[model samples]
Target chain A: MADHLSEPFKKSAMTNEEIMKTQREMRIQFIAFAFMIALTFLAFIAVGAEVAPPGFVISFIIFLAFIQLFLQLYYFMHLKDKDHGWANTFMVSGLVLSIPTIVALILIIGVVKY
Target chain B: MSETVDVSRGLPAHPERATLEGKNKFVGFWVFLSGEVTMFATFFGTYLGLRNGTAGGPEAADLFHMPLVFIMTMILLTSSLTSVIAITAMKKNQFKKMKLWMWITFFLGVAFLGFEIYEFVEYVHYGLGFSTSAFASSFYSLVGLHGAHVVFGLGWVLLLLIRYNRAGITLTNAPKFYMFSLYWHFIDVVWVFIFTVVYLMGIGGG
Candidate 1:
């Protein structure tokens, strides 16, 4: 129903046709990447010690890592809001399924219950 | 993207390149990435288990050399950025610019390979030979495979650069440039994991 209602971009919203990433934008994006990486390293240092449980710290870092990953994908990898449906679907599936399946296996194998 | 002036305008023939060239590369890349995800997933599982194993020998905390890995990571990541710049250059039809960036990218990749070779040499010297234990096997295999990919990617980029040095940015070479950039980025993604799982998480001794 919604599909019928929605216009097929009758004249699909034309893009600015401005070529990708101006020099200024590219420079800024690179700087932002550097900053995010620095923050990730800082996170590395923060969790360097025996702070919380190992898993807790790792999960926290991974949460932060995901943000950086998304930033890179959106800005650098160019999978921004303008992407097609398949890219989004594939990414979402990877994020949703890989975590549970992999983590569950790790838990099962490493628990060491006699 | 072929246009035919065949006065037969009744029904246009849309010859779709199987694998959809661009979409094919995209999907094929994803399929390859699936294998990668599964590969890394297995390593994560083993890493979690053996992380505690430490083989009663040594832990990640003692072994991690952050500076070396940090620089290596920086090189790989920087290559990702430059490759994109190359892609961007291609879109604007700047053949020379694309080649320059790709060449720069190629050199950076070689630098990364040099560092990896050195890192492995150091590991062996430090008595962390791959045959030492399960820990060493997984360690070398996972990280080394990534390094090998980088080496492989470097070769691919070099070949493209040489072959297309003068061809300029035609529609034909556009996809090739685009796919290389994709590969370069994927390698960076995998490195983020190596840094986290093998280096960072591996640090702190499990």
Candidate 2:
């Protein structure tokens, strides 16, 4: 058992159909990567060009950041796949818990003088 | 554990999750990642709160250089893509291709770390030491924590690559490499926020 586990296969087990499917998935991933890069560039440019108010630019860049976050988590990390229910749940819970934590800290620490 | 992995036919389509052990690692690593999300939020919240407390030190607007941050962001982002490619190749049982892409990812990560170290040195030279001010301390703690994760990840992947250098794509190492790729993507996700909340906001006069 251990020997088989460590041994390299003479050929891949993926069928031609499976290989084609994987290739298609790879293409989609590439498209997603391109979008992430575009989003990053947009965020940097939005800050660099200074075409908007500080408040607006801040929010814009943050919005872009969130889009990039979804792309990274879903596409790159495969969290969007069918078998990732538990992974998705845990990540969503973390994000849900995190918002309140961040808002509270900003309020308590930044607003209330200690 | 090895009993579950029957590789007699050929490499499994999803070699990373072929065995019960690999499946457990997959689920366990996600749980760890969830915890990490909250851990980082605390640092981020603290940084946001005290970012204004510069105490006469060089402020964010004064110290942050967009060009440097932009280049670092690009380097890290590209590394994320390379890892994605590596894992895709892994799924196809293209061992040599996967290894090549992983090496590219590793070098890109090293480049990103080099930029980060240089950025920190430049900040210290500008008098923004860890203890310089409330802002400085929180900034270092938050960004420095992320940097530490990068360092740890680089070490983890390097060790994996070296240990499995000649092992081929076995059921055991497949999960390991997949986990590292997930981790590498998570790092990029964090950097997206860092560049936005820290560097972009700093220079944008927020």
Best by lDDT: 2
- lDDT (Cα, tens digit) per residue for candidate 1, span B29-147: 65566556666667666656555554655556767787888888888778887887887666555667879999989999999989989988977877877777566777777788888
Ten contiguous residues with the weakest lDDT in model 2 chain B: B1-10
lDDT of each: 0.66, 0.91
Worst 10 contiguous positions by lDDT, candidate 1 chain A: A5-14
Clashing residue pairs, candidate 1?
Answer: A9-A12, B19-B24
Which stretches of candidate 1 lie above 4 Å from their native place? A1-17, A20-28, A47-57, A81-83, B1-20
Q: Which stretches of candidate 2 lie over 4 Å from their true place?
A: A1-3, B1-6
Candidate 1: what lDDT? 0.66
- DockQ of candidates 1 onward, in order? 0.17, 0.75
TM-score, chain B, each candidate: 0.85, 0.97
